[model samples]
Target: MGTLSPAAPPTTPERTKSRLLEAVKDCDCATAQALADKLGVTVPAIRRHLQDLQDAGQLEVRTEKPGGRGRPQHVYVLTEAGEATFPKAYATLCVDVLDQVERLFGDGAVLRVMDARRLEFQGVLASRLAGHSDLGRKLTALAAVLCEYGYAARAYQENGQWYLTQRNCPAPAVAKAFPQLCQAELTLYRDLLELPVSREARLSCGAAECRYKVG
Candidate 1:
């Protein structure tokens, strides 16, 4: 006879972890108590799965004050990696299906799909800037937007130019991450007559006010 089929693996652990992650994604963030409450499990059970996910580097655990709490409560947030596992797959499936449908439906459908995706990412920066004025506002706006772009951006002002310190670059993540995204940001100030603009930057991160010169 052929070798017996390998025993089916138990899915309890995976199910528990998936449910816990789903709780965080659905809630955006969750504490053990919250997850337990959501999943109708004990706090200890939820904590165990949370620890496992954190250990696996799929979740970021943070502490938050729960008002009457003696100290703080541990809150679990799904790391990008964790969300990537399932939600992204579903999204890819949807997009692939839609593309096939568009092929038969209309040619402009594909262009519309691309335009919508672009607008969704583009809106991130615009929403972050909401309302502000002048250079500080500009720096704050730029930092906020760049952070969304996955760059750990910080700004400092000195002399006349606002220097942006990029702790992380998102370019390599995107085939054409548009390095010019920065230049485009700088150009936003060209027409604003608040103060003369200067692109001359001197690298400094250790000074009291790290030299990010903005006039």
Candidate 2:
């Protein structure tokens, strides 16, 4: 069976901040104890972490009761600023990709090449997700790993294929305009993930570089 491992754990406080922010982005509220339990850390450790995060304005805490509860409990939620941190890694990745593209394709041709690369990337992801029984679970796993590498990915089903869309690119303004750049990214995706290794199989980008579907 093919299995994937999750991204490595955060190694620094700043990375921890980003992870915490991403974890709570969709959760309306979470308790310190609940967070500690989820993260597998001691309650005191979670309290200290939350205090530091709150001081940095990455999170806000308030006490509230949900009617059946005996007393109000403090719940932690991400601030607008906290949510902003989740995309910071992506912005960094874009800079690195754009710099390399400029070196290889000239500044003028970089964006075009990169956009095309992005489409090929989508095809690689589609190929990986093709035979999975639980598309959403597989995508969530894939996106989580991608998020760690500086791309905010979201995947959903379209027709019989899974479509993975990138909301933010480190080279956003350029990546949005050039399809070739996206195509180049697809090449990197193929190489990095060990995809399309078969002699008879070929990966190609489609009509829209922003979207890619594999057969």
Candidate 3:
């Protein structure tokens, strides 16, 4: 008699939750109905997974007022904790290149490279933010540029002070390895905003996200 073959592994709620998270990652936010349509699942199933993510502090819900609506729709976005679960290669590649450069020359070579990057970023940001005199608008434009570079940045104000919060870091590993990168980013913000910008929290220093206070 031949031995029986092993059964295939069944998909669990965890896998479903992962898929939901991935879908949310690709978009700014998603609704259960939208996610159901995208994933070919029922609304109830999508809600279940979303609830699980929320319970685990991985997702946030926002209500949107529909234009011709009867009721508001709930939109889900990945929290910083959730965004951290995604894959990031920029940090690893950056560290590898810096290591190679250091081995080829010296520690000073790494500083030069970082300074060069700072100058390039400054030029680009200056160009993008030109002709914007309003502090609020400048910060918004800066946030948009940062988002384009995978920072997931947003700008807001409280107590008459402007702030920028970045939910995701494209180079967490690199920033953790090289503090200069973080300083350079701070400098970039200060220069571009033409305001005194202080880093309130840093992902590299074990914070959930990086936040900057701009005046």
TM-scores for candidates 1 onward, in order: 0.36, 0.36, 0.59
Which regions in candidate 3 have their CA more than 4 angstroms from the true location? 1-6, 10-90
Cα deviation in Å at residue 64, candidate 1? 1.9
Give me candidate 2's TM-score against the actual structure. Answer: 0.36
Ten residues in sequence with the least summed lDDT for candidate 2: 197-206
Instruction: Give the per-residue lDDT digits (tens) of candidate 1, residues 111-215.
Output: 555555555655665556557666677677767776777767788766765665555543322212222333433444443323555544322212222123356
Predicted model with the maximum TM-score? 3
Off by over 4 Å in 1: 1-11, 66-71, 89-215
Best-to-worst ranking by TM-score: 3, 1, 2
Candidate 1 weakest ten by summed lDDT? 202-211
The lDDT-based order of candidates, best leading, equals 3, 1, 2
Model number with the top lDDT: 3
Per residue, candidate 2 scores C-alpha lDDT tens digits across 1-215 of: 97999998757766655555665675555887777666667788778888998898888988888564778889888888777775457645765676776788787767565556566666766666556656466656666656666766666676776555554454555444444555566565455444441112112222222333322
Summarize candidate 3's per-residue lDDT along 59-158 as a digit string, tens digits: 9999976665668889899899998888767667879998899899987887788888888989998899898899888889988998999999999999
State model 1's lDDT: 0.63
Alpha carbon lDDT at 107, candidate 2:
73
